[model samples]
Target: MPKLVRDRTLPALCPFCRAEILRPGEVEGGEWYDFAAGSCTCGAIFAHDPTARNGGAVFLQALLMVSGGDMDRAMELAEGVDYDVGYVQKYNVELHRLEPNSFGTLYFVRLRALGGD
Candidate 1:
């Protein structure tokens, strides 16, 4: 059986809103850490982990960005109760494709119900 191959010229979609995501830019507020980050129309935040091994860091960055630098709040929020998480695995940003042999990952986070909301 032949391995499936996906077209590499298409745009990537946001996991939460399904909107076509624009290529990420250097994230603000954390110049110390390098991340290609962006937000969706539905309020979901995303960060690309090129090496796929920095998912935890990537997730933290996304969470922090979404929460407006609230590290304490970001860490306290529960996965399903306060927010939701999703991943685009084997993602290749340059080609914007889900390459089967790649090791990149795009982490997504969306707040479900924050305090007083």
Candidate 2:
């Protein structure tokens, strides 16, 4: 079975509310906070904010997963996700744009989720 590892060091801030959201382990699954309900003691408000221009970490993570730890694959995945074939090819041609050399490692980890390991 594939194990979903949770970062134990995750901050108390909720991604949606920015409040100290309750941990899944702390309460039953049914009581988990709703994305719409941004209420929390920390006075954080819920904002359905879109990602930044650089595509952010989530995009990078997805890019790595589709790439299968291969630079070519990663570029292809990024292109496919971006819905631009030429952009992908161009990105691959210029590999210096992507940051954090660990993208390949992260991609491998994502592959494990799909039973690639």
Candidate 3:
């Protein structure tokens, strides 16, 4: 049996489980904003395409075509992008400049919009 996992902080609902959460939380600053992501408490899992949103696509495109694997510079450049959802960002362990390292692959995730929560 799959363990029940629940996380209401996700930008969207979990497809597998009908977990209900009030909503995600939001934080804001000058030219920057983020959401308080919820931890998955149940075993529910879902797959998402980072480039599904136009903002995500633009950022990913920049990271791949423009930055050419330059995650850091791409991140810096992506700051200006505004997503209807929330925003796009590169996330992962090991924060370093764009250099050859064991960091594997950089991850791009979409945050919830300010009022989405």
Candidate 4:
């Protein structure tokens, strides 16, 4: 007789509402886990699915390409995605200087564009 096995992975939590996330499947063209859940208590549907690569790097690259490397326009795009222009500006300054870290790249990018890289 063959033994049965089960997959055990901790459920992801929603960032906006702090609710338990229900994994549907892999995000389209993304390796990170994708989750869906009921509307948040705050009346907002929160969806968080990060890409397989560095988000910040991707975001910076896109912004540079779209805005022609204009920091001010990049800030505007960031604001359109519900991201704080100040925060994007702060990080972009470092990114423009060729800083040596890819951390928070995705977050910065998503917050800026609200779209995948």
Candidate 5:
């Protein structure tokens, strides 16, 4: 089984109240905030993953998952959100890790569009 490398507790703000919403008054990253989970004072479930190493990648995965593996839908969502992931030069983005005997994972993607135009 894959072990949990680490866990942290940050802050989660409330959308309606415009204040930090905590499971309790005082908390940290994973304790108060979870990348995979989020709740606001308004009781809204937010999918903001502050712990994510790459926000863009996380957003892409989220879009794909929510679209039920529909690439077109995911692309549409990405375009609608204005998170332009530059044209795919070449590379296969796999959501899974390679086998032990497989080569290393190296996916080349151009994120320059993130800057603009």
Candidate 6:
């Protein structure tokens, strides 16, 4: 495991609500074998992609979290209508900063109300 370092100047934040985010932790009973994840106060779930590749898996993890681990429910929802997606690229999980030229990314997913309200 790599040592985590924080950037004192800028704090990592949630893309949806701009709230300072907590460090990613092991997800309990998650779908994948091993993954780091966290959530924001505004109901957005995020998955850390250290390589910035595997975005599809990261996104699916987040969507599944928001959908209560229901893959069918997660797949049936339409983007922008049933939910919204946001991401912070160039993220550094160890440093907790959006470093320039980095390849890490944090994929976020927030579900919308079903009534079209």
Give the clash count for each candidate: 0, 2, 7, 4, 7, 0
Segments of candidate 4 deviating more than 4 angstroms: 1-8, 24-52, 57-117
Model 3, 1-117: lDDT tens per residue? 999865322223322233432222232221222222221233311112222344444335423323334457546654325221222132212332122322222222332222143
**Residue 72 Cα positional deviation in candidate 3, in Å, after optimal superposition:** 11
How well is each residue in 1-117 modelled by candidate 1, as lDDT tens digits? 999985554457888777888777787666634789888878888899999789888988888887887888888988988889988888788877667777888899899853225
Ordered list by TM-score, greatest first: 6, 1, 5, 4, 3, 2
1-117 in candidate 2: lDDT tens per residue? Answer: 999985333233433224444322111122222211122342222211121233334344333423433557655443323322111111111231222221211111122223222
Candidate 4 overall lDDT versus native: 0.33
* Top-lDDT structure, candidate number: 6
Between prediction 1 and prediction 6, which has the larger lDDT? 6
Model 5 Cα RMSD, 1 decimal: 15.3
Of candidate 6, the 10-residue stretch with the lowest lDDT total is 6-15
- The Cα error of candidate 5 at residue 46, in Å, is 4.2
lDDT minimum window of 10 residues, candidate 1: 5-14
Over 3-63, each residue of candidate 4 has an lDDT whose tens digit, in order, gives 8775332233334344543432223332222321122233323222233344444445434
lDDT of 5 by residue, 1-117 (tens): 989864332233333344553332211333312234223433332233233244565455434434444668656654435332221111111312222332222211222233344
Off by over 4 Å in 3: 1-13, 27-33, 43-117
* lDDT score for candidate 1 against the true structure: 0.81
Q: Local error of candidate 2 at 111, Å? A: 12
Cα lDDT of candidate 6 equals 0.82
Candidate 2 lDDT trough over 10 residues, lowest sum: 84-93
